[model samples]
Target: MEPNNDFEIFLVATPGLEAPLHAEAVEQGFADTKPVPGGVTCRGSWPEVWRANLCLRGANKVLVRLGGFPAVHLAQLDKRARKFPWAEFLRPDVPVKVEATSRKSRIYHAGAARQRIEVAITETLGAPVSSDAAVRVLLRIEKDLCTFSIDSSGEPLHKRGHKPAVAKAPMRETMAAMFLRECGFDGSEPVLDPMCGSGTFVIEAAEIALGLRPGRSRSFAFENLPSFDPNAWSSMRQQQPLAKPDVVFHGSDRNSGAIEASTKNADRAGVADFTMFQTRSVSDIKPPSDAAGLVIVNPPYGARIGDEKRLRSVYGSLGKVLQTKFKGWRIGIVTSNAGLARSTRLPLLPPGPIVDHGGTKIRLYQTGVLT
Candidate 1:
């Protein structure tokens, strides 16, 4: 498929992690990074889109703008929707879903607006629209302007198509990746997640070290688009060499169920060979090897476990364990409760920006040397 030069790609991030996302985007060689309300906007081609999806650790999803038009009323919306070149991107056999959101616009009725869009697309391109469609076309009407885009990613990028099970309050894969990046992990050194509930940190670390594409195991909505070229996709897929890491990646959880879940998830992510999961508590945790490494933990917050006091003790024990056991290793802790995190008295620097995980605002606290 020919690349669309006029389109813009937006990397949507968690609420307070826009700066990190912007930095990561620029580090990954994006031409420009514009900090927006909830994310960063970067200009790139289809290859860049693929790279962003693979390399970006903080972005929730990458959206490509297909078309836009100013519409103050319903008639203009209908007329402009009809003018969009839907046939260029969508296939008639692939069912499409229309989702609409409005802000400060005359078309306040989202249902009516979606109906107008569906009618316009079906009438103009002979494409079928269903509520349960696999592909989604998002419509945004803000300040009398309507923006249209097809969701390049069907399932949210966090799914990664690898993890089939989750523990209580599982950390998102994207957030886990970003947190690891923030801790200065580059896949060259060992990474230990002492409280790795579902092995997100370890798996993401292994993927980064080995240059594995996070999207390799997952299917995208764009794959079903009319413009999708199987030859190009196959070439791209074949070009990525499998990454094998020699360093140790370790994760431990108190619950045997969590350890089992992490093992299965790592296996699905194709990083099982690089990772080691064990059933152990934080108090019993030790560095993977005598060598210094990055230690990241996403322990239970009070909200999920319903006992802030008990979790505080757990955090205190973790801090003591880190201070006495792993002296030179860097420590990263993700939590929603600042008080609970403060219990880990390791002379921690100010926590990084907050991120939304399952509706809770959580922050990352880093301590020790980031070697």
Candidate 2:
């Protein structure tokens, strides 16, 4: 690869949800998009990196895999690291954080490897090293091959910068957006989250419907890179005409605090006019008076809702509400327990594969338009 050549751009997807993210990448017209084990790989320039961070809703992070080489020992790694063109990718002024992982390799001390890379950047490239820096340089030593990549997303993309008041076990924006896409929601129909916590799903739905960019309110680490072009990027970041949806997205939660957080979050995200949040339990929740659309909920699967015995009643109420009141509306319920889902008694189709939610495993159980 040339000094300034485009490398592999990996759009990191949440584990077990790679297919939907890959589908999103392909739909977004990313060139040479192919889903790898941990992420979707594509080829694009630095501007493409910015665009990926800006537009890809399902990506957790965008990693630029600058080419790797075989290194059997720390000395060889040090020599090559010192010679690599860090000045081309990293600015001398911006601080950097170096993280490493070793798997089945001789140079297996991840801490030592990270230290060497950090020294190389600080000493050889004249950059300050910081553990908390937003721009991260990642080193992976696997089977004696050392690969380096840069994390373009300083904060996780799910932060969205606009939503600071989140409820317990809040669904990540990235995961919610993909689940929304998986449910065949393309901003054409209304969306409601009866168990909306912090309004992540509702806000994401409104953003999608309004054609708002997820990263619009956030700054990316890519802006600190050596290749960053402010003028071109600013011109590219120019807002497209937003679409006005015909139906309002809605979210309801039994907790008044959750309702407050959701409402405030929607306002910060600039989708307040397109969203409605209310304090209501599942039993009291009903579909909008006139609109029949998709009902997507992320209920508490753990003890937050209640003990297992008590949760059966809660799930049952949710199921009963959808079954009786939401006729002709589609439903997508995300939870960790199959039994809890079964208690809902809604005709749930087979769920998609299990998704990693922090440490817990969850799945989205879907239903067709209800009877």
Q: Which candidate is the best by TM-score?
A: 2
| Candidate 2 global TM-score | 0.97
lDDT of 1 by residue, 1-371 (tens): 22465457888887877877788888878877798988898777666666676656678888888768898889889988888888887887888899999999988988889999999989988889998887899999999888887777777788787789788777888878778888888888999998888888998899888887777777777787876767877777776766677797999988999899999998988888899999998899887887798999888897777699888899999999898888789999988999998898877889888787778888999986732
**Pairs that clash in candidate 1:** none
TM-score of each: 0.94, 0.97
- Cα lDDT listed for each candidate: 0.83, 0.90
Worst 10 residues of 2 by lDDT: 299-308
Error of 1 at 42 (Å): 1.8
Question: Model 2 over residues 196-295: C-alpha lDDT tens digits?
Answer: 9899999999999999888888999999998899998898789555999998999999999999999999999999999999998888988774878999
Residue 281 alpha-carbon offset, candidate 1, angstroms: 1.7
* Candidate 1 regions with alpha-carbon error over 4 angstroms: 1-3
